[model samples]
Each structure stands twice: as structure tokens, then as C-alpha cells.
Target: MTRVLLLGGTTEAGRMARALADAGVDAVYSYAGRTEAPVAQPLPVRVGGFGGVAGLVAYLRAEGISHVIDATHPFAAQMSRNAVEGCAAAGVALIALEREPWQAGEGDRWTHVPDLAGAVAALGEAPRWVFLAIGRQNLSAFAGAPQHHYLLRLVDPPTDPLPLPRAEAVIARGPFDVAGDRALLKDHRIEVIVAKNAGGAGAEAKLVAARELGLPVVLIDRPLVPERRVARTLGEVMAWLDG
Candidate 1:
């Protein structure tokens, strides 16, 4: 059996692992230990980072890894780059599974910003209410918008204390329900929402809710990735594997 390692954390990561398993490939799924009980996939799994590039290279060579599929989050720039370098060092096949980001449509009020700080800067002082869906890692930027109240939703409790005067945390995972989202928006009296373009159905209903409410959204663009062999879908990844 061919040995494949899947660097997983994204939703499609699980699917990609299953796809490889179905094709009779001996695949091992790896996660970055970021999530609290990430959804289980149908393969042997390893959690936590592989130290760095050197450690990953050692793992690749020692395990006789034939191929590597990077399915980490778009913001995981460091790991993605490490994979590219590590694969080269070990002479292993590498592919990136990246999905298209959600695009703004008619009735979608979007203000595209370069980063999280930029997203906060876009919110002017207006005694506003905002829904911060940017996850647990980077909520400190919102502290600058003290005039605004924020409704922060995260899977885990934030490690650092929030600087906002008025803020609430909702512990939940999604693909959220559009109706429930709409209610939360209405209940919080949110005028603006901040979200990252982490594509796919997981936590996507908030976008739908924002669209329905006609609420303005501050969308953070995805981080840039290094040049790599990319596949937009699982089928495409499977095809690459077959080839």
C-alpha cells in the first residue's frame, strides 16, 4: 500500500482523507491541534504540528511518505510553506487542496479589508454593534473600536481577555442555521459583521444571515500562499493522486 500523509484541519481535509482511503492508499491524517474536538474523519489521525520544516522532513523520510496533501486553513501560511519545503527535502509528492473563497453577490454589503486590523479600522465610530466571527485567535484588534459593542462567536473561550467595553462570547460550532443566525443578529442589534473568507459550509450561514439582513460586513481576505500544485476539489485531488 502507498503511504500518504494528509495535513488536515479544514473541512475538506476529512473528505480528502476518506477519498484517499477509498482508493486503497494508506493515508494518515494530521491536524495542528488547534481545534477543540475537531470533527472525526475516517482514517488514522495525528494531532499537533510536526515541530517545523526539519521535523516534518524527518517524519516524511522515516515514514516512507510517498505523497503529501495540504488541507490546512488558508491562514495557515507558515505550515503551508513548511510543507512545500519539507516535501522538497524528502522528495515526496505534495499537493494543496484549496477551495474558492465566497464571493460577494447582489444585496451583499461587503467591505473588503486586507487583514484583521484593517477590518477594525474600517469600522468608524458610530456607537455601532458588530458581530465578530473572525475566530478566537485575533479579537484584540476590535479593542480599537471601543465605541462599538461586539458579539464574538468562537468554538473555544478566548485565552486573552477582550478589551472591548461591551462584548459577549458565543461558544458554538457551525455550519450555523440561517434562522438562528438572523435571530442572533437581530437580538444583538448588530449593524456590522466581521468574518474571514474561510470558505465552505462550516459557519457559512452567518454570511447568509448577513445577506438577508442587508447588514454591512467587513470581510478579511485570505492569506497569500506559496506557489504549489493545487486542487480545487476532492475529485481533482483524486485525479492528481491517480496520475
Candidate 2:
């Protein structure tokens, strides 16, 4: 009787999907259709957006979705917000499966910025070799500070020219290792790194590499969303579903 919708994208979302499938939960996984080749999920998959809050509410009611587990990326504030509003309107239970944000540690040279614009302003006027580790979506924002050479690592190669004038892209996927990231930073003579505070071990290697190389990092804080129930672990999520 419990039909569930798993709003997914992150590595944690994949794990949650597997857990739901293993438990034989009646669930459907939804992708925002950003990635060209998304990781195959065990549950029935739906690509693209739910239009907006109204469309999402309609879908939930039409599909009889009793619960929604939002496991989207921390930076995906809009989609997360839509989920919150839609679930509330549909009178369905909603919970977020989110990882804690990464914290600066001893020996880590980090400059925390409230948003993308702040991160860009933090770069200053000097043109330094920067590792723009924030992914491909917001690459254009850095074009404002085009003096710096940017090193980008992306899951897919860009079909069009990058917005930045002095930027190069490395086509690869992660759970990247620290040694490789360290070598990459050294090879590029990177002076700084700009990254989203998307926590978890998969993307933490770059931060570790930066710390080891004594390079500064411009860390963008996660966007705030409407408050909702959140579960941090697989066990916790499953318990929430069971309860």
C-alpha cells in the first residue's frame, strides 16, 4: 500500500535505491536529466523534471505516491524545494537523505563563501592557477574572473566551448582518489581550488589533496531549502520508511 518516490542523483541516492530494491519496496527513482548517462538504478526510473510544484503534486496524486525520499545533491536547492512543496500539497510524507557538509580541519586552508557569487569575488584581481572543482553547470560564473587559468574535471566532455577563456577540462568520473588528485594539482601547478561543500568520501579526495599541497580552497556553502525531515544513513532512512 506504500508507494514511494525516490528523488535521486547523488552517490547516496544510488545506495538508497539499492536498499529500497533489496527490501522490495514499491519505489520509483527520478532523475533531473542533467547527466547524459546516469547510473542505472534498480527501481523503475523516470528522467526529466516533474515540471514544477504543481506538476509534481499532480504526479504524486496520480501515481499514489505515499512517501518521497529526496536524495538530491546538496546544491540542488530548487528541486529539493519543489519536492518539499509538492509533497506537502499532495499530503504525502517527505524526508531528505542528505550527507553532512564537510568541515575545515587543522592544516586545511579554506575560504568559505556563502554562494557562487561570493566564491567568484574571493578569487580577487590576481590571476592564479585555479582548480574549479564545482562541476560544469556554473562554469560561466568564473568567466567574470577570466584572468585565472581554471582546471575543470567533468563526468562528460563539453560539446560546446567553455565560457572561460583560459580553462581546460579533464573528462573523468569520481569517487576520485587523493593520490591522483594530488598529482593532478601538482601537474597543473594549481594555486587554489573552488568546490561545493558536497560532503561524503567520493569527492573529499580533492580537498585532502589541496590540504596536502598547502593550497587554498574556495568552498561554496550549500544553499538553504525549506525545512523537512532528514535522514543521514541507510538505517535511518529505512527506519523512517518502516515507521
lDDT of each: 0.87, 0.95
Tell me the tens digit of each residue's lDDT in model 2 across 158-212. Answer: 9899999999999988899999999999999999999999999999999999998
Residue 238 of model 2 has an lDDT of 95
Q: State residue 24's C-alpha deviation in candidate 1, in Å.
A: 2.7
Write out the backbone clash pairs for model 1: 174-203, 175-203
Q: Which residue runs of candidate 1 sit more than 4 Å off their true CA positions?
A: none
Q: Specify the poorest-scoring 10-residue window by lDDT in model 2.
A: 137-146
Q: Quote each prediction's TM-score.
A: 0.93, 0.99
Evaluate model 2: give its lDDT.
Answer: 0.95
- Cα RMSD of all models vs. native, in order, equals 1.7, 0.6
